[model samples]
Target: MHVPEQIPDHLDFVGRGWHPLLTRLHEQLVAVSPSYSVQQVKEKYGTLRIHLYTGMLRHLNLGNTDWPDPDQAARYKDEDDAARALVHAAEQESARTCEACGNPGVPRDRAWIKTLCDDCAGHR
Candidate 1:
């Protein structure tokens, strides 16, 4: 796998295609943790994840990306649950929100599964 040259604290590890959604997510995280880092980003079951899970994967939204605190999600413990919850919440938001226009969108399953706004849907 190719690694990124650097991982910015407040920026996303994904691409510009998801800027609208990611920017909003970044803003939300800044309100809580300014130093948060995004570990990954891609359309769920899209080109990114398809290299691993296919045939078995029928549905997907935005790609799965994790917030900071890697070990927090390993197992949701009493104390770690809160942290994991925050990360999960953000991820779900990305799945539901539009990656282009930052509007409410649903997962589109055409050739690839992607979360998009009505206007931006299939426009790519």
Candidate 2:
């Protein structure tokens, strides 16, 4: 029998969860030009330029609101609105069902309706 490897308890910036993709992204960001700091990067390029970069990054990772530029903020808002529309469309198209049990009812937690039953969601 093989034992599974354990993940560490605290992952701070990546947020708390078993997200390997986030972990991998964190590693890649650290690996590429590791010496530069966020402030340094921002200062090197003007604030607006940095904000543009931040907006691009925000699509990949949600919790990256360092110093958003006006254009970037607008772009992020648009993307968020589009995502909401897509989810609304999905709900309208699909039968009203509990994602886990497939029971026809309003989901207990709509945010996590994708990967969890009520019982499993609590435990996880």
Candidate 3:
């Protein structure tokens, strides 16, 4: 797969067609908060899967730091919500996009389920 330089190498496991989608999502996350980091990206049940992390979540995990005050916390929550919405949109788009060639597609069932265009499905 031709992984984009902006994306981490570990996420290259996902299909090439979704690279643009991933890249756009990454850019959106960065705009929301540069601290956002993608932990995983993959294909599951013929759809794209993405996992992400942020410093705010890490702070919460530490359970010791009152890192952000109430006002800041509310702002962070809004940003997080926006990020989640973006991810959902990307995943929904993936369902209709060919995993092999980025064309319009639908989920297909064989030995394994995959989202593919008619042409790409024929070759498989």
Best candidate, TM-score: 3
Instruction: Give the candidates in order of TM-score, highest first.
Output: 3, 1, 2
Encode model 1's per-residue lDDT on 1-124: one tens digit a residue: 3232212332344434456544554455444443333345455642221011111110111243544254543422322343345455656766766766667777778877777778888587
TM-score list, all predictions: 0.48, 0.29, 0.84
CA-lDDT, candidates in order: 0.46, 0.33, 0.77
- Give the per-residue lDDT of model 3 (tens digit) for 1-124: 2222334554568878778777788888778766665667789989988776554673464464677988877877887788788888999999999988889999999999999999999999
Off by over 4 Å in 1: 1-12, 15-42, 46-79
Candidate 3, residue 60: CA error in Å? 3.2
Q: Name the candidate that leads on lDDT.
A: 3
Candidate 2, residue 105: Cα displacement in angstroms equals 12
Off by over 4 Å in 2: 1-65, 96-124
lDDT of 2 by residue, 1-124 (tens): 3221111222232212213322343344334322212211111110011111122443344445476788977865665454334333433322233333333333343443333345535554
In model 1, the worst 10-residue window by lDDT is 50-59
What C-alpha RMSD separates each model from the true structure? 10.9, 15.2, 4.7
Residue range with the least summed lDDT across 10 consecutive positions in model 2:
40-49
| Number of clashing residue pairs, candidate 2 | 0
